[model samples]
Target: LLLSVPDSTTGTISVTGLNGASNPSFLGMFTTIAGFEPAGANFNNHYPMQDNVSDFHLYDIGEFFPIQPVADYNAETGIILPPNPNLSGQLKEYQIEFDGFEQVHVDVFGLVTSQNGPNIRTA
Candidate 1:
């Protein structure tokens, strides 16, 4: 999920994963920049930030600084299951809430495991 904040205020965003049989896991959130060509064309770019090792000075560009989340409740390997009386059987629901600042872009990463197999997918 890509979120673009228009104002300079603190806010919270909620992400939910609904599945009939399994609960999806919420991974870490990250900020990224859009790649652009000099001729005005846009392209995909992969610039990963290393935790505790990445230098923001080398990647910072004016107002396009990295936006970090204030509080992430699901930034771990734990499974989140919200209480819902409407759900039954193997059905499960997961919700992740995080705080963010204004005038920034964020990406919410998540992981979902396949119920039929051992394969896992990223979202």
Candidate 2:
């Protein structure tokens, strides 16, 4: 199952496996890491505030940035790409850095087993 946040433009995606029956299990996750491109693209140069939920976790724009400690959250993983979600669905204005211009196409592969049965309307 895929959940998208159309309102807000930026956020992380959490992939949980659900069996046909409970809570979902963690599969994989991924977050944006700034400063991977141009020299001026360092996260510290543009956004100084550190948000764990933000895709970019580290930036060295000529500053002593205390990198966000990597965790088992939805923003960190080698095999997961997070979906966008926002709390306020009305005002959705978000801008982020991506390798691709405008949009980025992602591919995910995993066998999700849900604990909730099909009777439950997750949609």
Against the true structure, whose lDDT is highest?
1
Model 1 alpha-carbon drift over 4 Å, by segment: 19-123
lDDT tens digits, residues 32-120, model 1? 33221123323243232322322111111112113332222355856555644553323234354556543334433223334546765
Candidate 1: give the clashing pairs.
none
* Full-model lDDT for every candidate: 0.35, 0.29
Clash count for each candidate, listed in order shown: 0, 13
C-alpha lDDT of residue 53 in model 1: 20
Each candidate's TM vs. the true structure? 0.22, 0.15
Give per-residue CA lDDT, model 2, range 16-88, as digits (tens). Answer: 2233212233332224333223333333533312234333322111211233333233545555433334311
Once fitted onto the true fold, the runs of candidate 2 whose alpha carbons sit more than 4 angstroms away are 1-89, 100-120
C-alpha RMSD in Å of predicted model 2 compared with the true structure: 19.8
